[model samples]
Target chain A: MLKNITLGQYFPGNSLIHRIDARFKLILTALFIAMVFCAKTPAGYGLIAAFLIFVVADSRIPPRLILKSLRSILIFIVFTAVLNVFFTKGETVLFSWRFLTVSREGIVFAVSMVLRIVFLIVGTSMLTYTTSPILLTDAIEALFSPLKKLRFPVHELAMMMSIALRFIPTLIEETDKIMSAQKSRGADFESGNLFRRVKSFIPLLIPLFVSAFRRADELATAMESRCYRGGDGRTRYRVMRSAARDWVALGAAAALTAGVVVLRIFGL
Target chain B: MEILRAEHITHIYSPKTPFEQKALDDVSFSVSPGELVGVIGHTGSGKSTLISHFNGLLRPTSGKVFVEGEDIWAQPKQIRRFRFRVGLVFQFPEYQLFEETVEKDIAFGPKNMGLSAEETAERVREAARSVGLDESLLEKSPFELSGGQKRRVAIAGVIAMRPRLLVLDEPAAGLDPRGRDEIFDTVRAYLASGENAAVVVSHSMDDVARTASRIVVLDRGRVALEGSPAEVFSHRDVIESTGLRLPFVTRVMHRLRDRGFAADVSVRDLDEAADALLRLKGGGGRA
Candidate 1:
């Protein structure tokens, strides 16, 4: 059952998006997130939507995959929408009930909040879908290289994040194995009261935590045996370089920001 | 009566996705009561997947699993009951040990069956004894036990339920020879109780040949071979084609026969081969 999780999962593709430099894609993703939040007017949202659609189409990633990632945080999205719909007070009321109010402004606010969240998630997912975890971490370490002057452990932090991301699937698969093991022993994780169900998870959680620590210890030993002593003096085999396509991607991000800024300034 | 049967089982993993692959295809088998069936296959040959179907842990894309003549998936809700009837000890089952104490871990299954505390404790002690775990060690935490002890505890947890059909997926995997022998002995004794059957999934042909009465060979999700151990070992070429080999003794017997020595080539283990060779020697080396 845990296999359905698609969070941070990378899809292999040979499209322009996949070929673009990881550093450029990362920067554009952050810029896209900012532009989505800055979109307050219908024209701004329409522009962002168009750009996202164009990116999705060009990337060639299956739309179903993008939608699957959204499934994980769907509850959060619905909650935010409902909160905005029922609680945001406005001068123009659409419907009123005892202690519950739905206003025209509330409807717009709810729709915008949901749209912003959806766009933010899809935009970030596009970045991960196109870039492999190793490349993504390399790009992050390179982006943070400037902070080395501040005496920060930028490389170490990036290594840690990458390791964590790399093990997400492994840990998930382990969890599934442990769950099935416990299930075969007559541990019922489903069809129980809330309390009983929570109690049943003890069999699964303890073993998962134990195995995770064991894995971490093994990984540490394996690394140490290979003479890994932090990122100092470590040279990468693959160097990140900006290609012509990367420059075009940067320009596209700039154009998106400009569009959002123009729509805000014109009050469209 | 047949304790378990899988009919034309076909399991396609992540169907309709890029990861789509057939883990099992058109496989059928049955385990009768008191039979020890050893399932041997190369990695990813669907041995684990087929065993998972016996207890309804996995649903086949197109097939049916029957436990005690009733379709496990017919009701769906009562599939949990089949779990108690068909206990599956996963690969490296030591990782499944979770209860605070060894005693409690072994009792977990019976408790889940809603047995009274007295009955659960009795079953726990019996299960521990069956696995050769000392009564003195039951009070200690499972974490305090050695690796072999921990695995036995996990096995005892399932055995306490007294499942009519026990399915073990590489129970002796990642263990020393002594540890593997201990586990194999315990499982053999457990099946000797006359009320239960067993299906052991193993890559170790020697271990399976020594323990199981029947051997089922899976090659790429299909039943490549199935028969008594002697019968299956007789066809060493077919078994080896699936990236598996007959037990060492069986191979020795085959070589002896090929060398024109009057020897029975159907020996399953070292003891049987030794007896057959001694008999041939006593008979003046003639068949």
Candidate 2:
């Protein structure tokens, strides 16, 4: 059951989108999110929706999956939209009930807020879906490269982050095996009252922690054996460079931003 | 007389997902009381899935597990008790050790059974002695133990529950030849007691041949062969089809028989093979 939980997991592929620089996709996703928020009119929102659909279709990733990842947070989205629709002080009262009044401006604000959240998640997911996690970490290090000038310990921070991300799947696999082992020994994790439920976690947690530390020790020894000194003078195997397609893609994004601005200014 | 019965059990992992696997498909088998059955299969042949269903660790997709003629799933609330009745020591169970001391760790299963402290302690000692763990070592942390010792402690943890039906999945995995012998000896001792039955799931044909009275071969979650060790070993063609080989001792006897020597191909254990050879030649020469 735990193994099936693949929310936001990267799928390996060799499409053009997957081949693009991870750094480029990260920046583009950020720009796309900003553009979605800047849009207000119906046509602008429609374009943002179309852009998300286009990206998903182009990447050959099913849109339903991107939506499926949002399943757990559906309540949060609904809560936010409902809170905005009712609490925001607006002028145009479209309808009035006993204790609830629906305002046109409030509805618009709610719709835009919901759209902003939807686009934010979908747009960010593109960076993850198209790029492998290792490439994504490398891009993050490159993005934070300037922080090294201020002696921000960028190497160590990024290394930790990358290790953490790398171990998520491995730890998940370990947890599955441990859970099964515990269950076989009659570690009753599924039943009982509140106290019993909490008590049930002892078997799972202790062994998991033990193996996690053991794995960490082994990994550190392996790294040391490989002579893995930190990023003092590391040279790159794959250097990031701006390509023709990359430049064209960035320029197209800038043009789209300008178009959205023009449309907003003209109230289209 | 069926102690544990799995009726037409089918199981699928990650159902409907891209990574979905039909682990077991309509597999059915039963073990009678006082029987030591060896379950043999490849790594992903659904052997683990089949064992897990015996105690309701996993419910089959379309079948039933009846322990003593009562469906294990009939009263889901009593599943924990069912677990005590049919103890499952998972593959490489050393990964599940948690308590501060070896004694406490070994007592985990019986403690879960809600046994009194004195009773749990006695069971723990019995289990520890059965697995050859010394009294002094029982006070040490499991983390302070060697790999084989920790694995033995883990096995003891399950054994302390004094289950009527004990199931061990690859209990000898990661152990050296000596450690493997110790585990097989302990299992044989448990069976020799006559009140307890066991199911040993293993990939090593030698281990199964030495310890099990009856043998069961699983391929893709279905029972490919089921009978006494001699009966099952006779189906060499079907066993090879599942990508399993006969034990070296069995093969040696088969080769001898094929060479027109007066030898019995029905022997499963090395001792029996040696005895049969000695009967034919009247000497204990290492052939």
Best model per lDDT: 1
What would the per-residue lDDT of candidate 2 be over residues B76-184, giving only the tens digit for each residue? 8878788888888887788898889998899888887888999999999999999999999999999999999988898888888888788999988888999999998
Model 1 misplaced regions, further than 4 Å = A37-44, A71-114, A263-268, B252-264, B274-287
| Model 1, position B105: C-alpha lDDT score | 91
Instruction: Extract clashing residue pairs from model 1.
Output: none
- Over A1-268, each residue of candidate 2 has an lDDT whose tens digit, in order, gives 6877774479777776777788888788778977987898888888778877777887887767787877767898999999888877789998877878779888999988888888887788788888878788888899999999998888778788889888998889888888877776678787789999998898999989988998999999999999889889988887888677777777777777777777788889
Candidate 2 collision pairs: none
The runs of at least 3 residues in candidate 2 whose Cα sits more than 4 Å from the true structure, single-residue gaps closed, are A233-244, B251-287
Model 1 TM-score on chain A: 0.88
What are the models' TM-scores?
Answer: 0.90, 0.92
Docking class of 1: medium
Residue B59, candidate 2: Cα error in Å is: 0.9
lDDT of 2 at B182: 93
